[model samples]
Target: MKSHIYITRHGESQWNVECKVQGITDTPLTSKGIEQAHELAKKIKESGIKIDEILHSPLSRAADTAKIIAEENGLPLTLEPRLVEQNFGEYEGHEWKKYPGVFHEAKKQFACDYNGGESMLRLGQRIYNLLDELKVRSEKENKTFLLVTHGGIARMIHSYFNSETNEEFSSTNTGNCEIKEYVF
Candidate 1:
C-alpha cells in the first residue's frame, strides 16, 4: 500500500536573507519564516490532510517550523538527525557566490565531499534510510507523515525518488517553506 507523505523545507533563516551558506549551521527563522510556518499549518488544515506525526531536522530553523506546525495540527513532533542539511564544511556562513565552483562540483559529483563536508551521496543515503524507516512505520500504523527539513535535504529527497540523472537532480531546488507531497 502507498503512504501519503508531506514534505516541506524550513522557512527562511537569517542566513537565507543574507545569502550565506547555512549547511549544518544553526540559525533562527525570521518573522516572515514564522508566518510561513503558520500559513502552512493553515493550508494543511484547510485541505483536510491528516498528519499522524511530524519529523523535523534538528536545526533551529526546521525545529521551530515543525513546532508551530505540529502544535497547530495537534501532531507529535520528533527530531530526526538524518533529516539535517548537508554539511558545507568551510563554506558554512560564507557567501554562496564566492564558492560557485564548489556548488558546481558537488552537483556534478554526488559523492564529492565539499571542503571536508558531507557528500551528496551520503546525504541521499541518510534521507533514503529515514524514508525507508518511515515507510515501514507508516505501513504498520496506517499513518501519514509530515517531514520538515532543509532545502538541501529536501532537494535530495526529491531527487532520490524523482530524478533519473545527476543533472536532473542537481537542477532541482526547493523554496523556503515550500511543500511537496508524494504517495509512496
Candidate 2:
C-alpha cells in the first residue's frame, strides 16, 4: 500500500520577523505564525483527510505546530531529529544578508558547508534516510503521515521529489505553514 505524505514548514518564528537566520536555533512563533498553524489545521480538518501520525522537528516552532495539528486531529505526535533544519553553524542568528556568499556556494554545490555548518549533501542524506524509513513503515502499516518541519527541510523535501539539478534544488522555497503533498 502506498501512503500519502503531507509536509509543512513551521509558521514564522520570532527570528523570522526579526530577519535573522534561525538554523537550529530555537525561537517562539509569532502571532501570525500561530494563526497560520491554526489555519493549516482547519484546512486539513475540512479536507477530511485521515492522517495516521504526525512527525515534527524538535525545534519549538515546528513542535508547536505539530502539537496544534495533532490535538486538532486527535493524532499522536512524534519528534524526528532528522527533520530539523540544517545547522548553519557560525551563521546562525545572523542576518541572512550577511551570508550571501555562503548561500551562493550552497546553490552551486551540494557539498557546500556554511562556515563549519552541515553540508547540503549531508542534510539531504539525512532527510532521504528518514524518508526511506518512513516509506517502508508506511507501506507495511498502510499509514499516512503529516510532517511538520522547518523551511529548509521543506525545501529539501521538495527537491528530493522534484528537482533534477542543484540549481533547481536551491531554488525551492516554502512559505511558513505551507503544506505540500507527496505520494509514496
Candidate 3:
C-alpha cells in the first residue's frame, strides 16, 4: 500500500512574527504558535489521520512542533538535519522584507540564490533525499510518517510533490501545528 505522509512548517517563531529571516539559527515558538499546534492536534484527531512516525528538523521550532504532534497522536518522533531550513548565509539575520537586496531577491522567485548559502537546487536535493528515505521505509515497512521542517524546506517539499512547475505552489499561512497532508 502507498503510504500517506504529512509535511508541516513549524509554528510561528518570535523571528517569524517579527518578519526576520530565521535560516539555520534556531528560535522558540511564540505563545500563539503553541495555540496553533494545539489546534492542529485537534484537527488531526477530527480527521482520524494515523501518523506512524514523525520526523523533525534539528531546529528547536520544528522539533517542538513535531514533538507536540507526535505526543498528541502517540507516534514516535526523530530529528533529521536534512529537513532543516536552507542556510541564509549573509542574509541570516537581516530583515529581507525591509532590506533592499533581500526585498529584490524575493521577487526573483526560483531564479534567486541565497548569498553565500545553499542554493535552491541543493536545498531541493536535501529534501529529496529525506523523502527517498521515507519512501523506502513506507514501501518496505508499510509505515506512514510526518515531517516537521522550516518554511524554505517545506516549500521544497511542496514543490517536490507538486512537481517542478513554473508556477510556485505556496502553502496557506500554516500557523503553528497546522497539518498539510500528502498521500503517495
Candidate 4:
C-alpha cells in the first residue's frame, strides 16, 4: 500500500519575529503566526488531502501547530522528540545577523557543536532515526500522516529525501505551515 507524508515547519514565533535564534528554547507563536496556521488549516482542508495521523516535535511551537491541525482534523497527535530543532548550543537565543561566521561555520567539514547543544551530525542522525520509525509506522498502518517540525528539522528531512548531497539544504526561509508532500 502507498502512503503519503506531509511535512511542515511551525509558524512564526516571537523569537522569529525578533530575529533571534531559537534552536532549543521554546517560544510562543505570534498573533500573525496563529492567523497563518488558521489559514493553513483552511488550505489543507480545501486541498482534500487525506491525513490519517499527525506527528509533531514536542517543542512548543511545532506541537502547537500539530495540535491545531489535529483538532481541526479530529486525529490523534504524537509527539516525536526527534523532530525537534537542531540544538544551537551557545547560539540558542542570539540574533542571527549578529552571530558572526555562524553561516560559514555550519558548513564546515567537521560540524561544530553549539556548546551544550547537539552537533549537526548528531541532529541528522536523530532525524534519520525518526524517519526510519515513521517509515515503519507508515508501512504498518498504510496511512497518510503529517509531521509538524522546525525549519532545521524540515531541512534535514528534505536533505534525506534528496539523498544528502553536498548541496546545501537550508530551510531558513520556509514559511509557516508550508506543506511538503512525500509519497512511497
Cα lDDT computed for each candidate against the true fold: 0.86, 0.85, 0.76, 0.79
Task: Name the better of 2 and 3 by lDDT.
Answer: 2
lDDT of 4 by residue, 129-166 (tens): 87877788888977788999888788777776776544
137: Cα error in model 2, Å: 0.9
140, model 3: CA deviation in Å?
Answer: 1.1
User: For candidate 1, lDDT tens digit of each residue in 14-128?
Assistant: 9999989889999999999999999998898899988899999999999999999999888899999888899977667877777665664556677777779998878878888
Candidate 3 on 27-131: residue-level lDDT in tens? 899888777777776777789888788889998888888778878878788888898888876667778567755433452354456667776777777888888
Residue 127, model 4: Cα distance from true site in angstroms = 1.0
Best by lDDT: 1
Native-to-model Cα distance after best TM-score fit, residue 7 in candidate 4, in Å: 0.8
Residue 19 C-alpha lDDT in model 3: 81
Model 3's C-alpha root-mean-square deviation from the true structure amounts to: 2.6
The stretch of ten residues in a row with the least summed lDDT in candidate 1 is 99-108
Off by over 4 Å in 1: 99-102
In candidate 4, list every pair of residues with a backbone clash. Answer: 89-114
| Best model per TM-score | 1
What C-alpha lDDT, on a 0 to 100 scale, does residue 16 get in candidate 2? 91
TM-score of 3: 0.86
Q: Model 2, 1-184: lDDT tens per residue?
A: 5577989999989999987878898999999999999999999999998899999999999999999988987889999989998997766887767666566455456676777888888988999899888899898888888999987788788876775676666667789988889987
Worst 10 residues of 2 by lDDT: 99-108
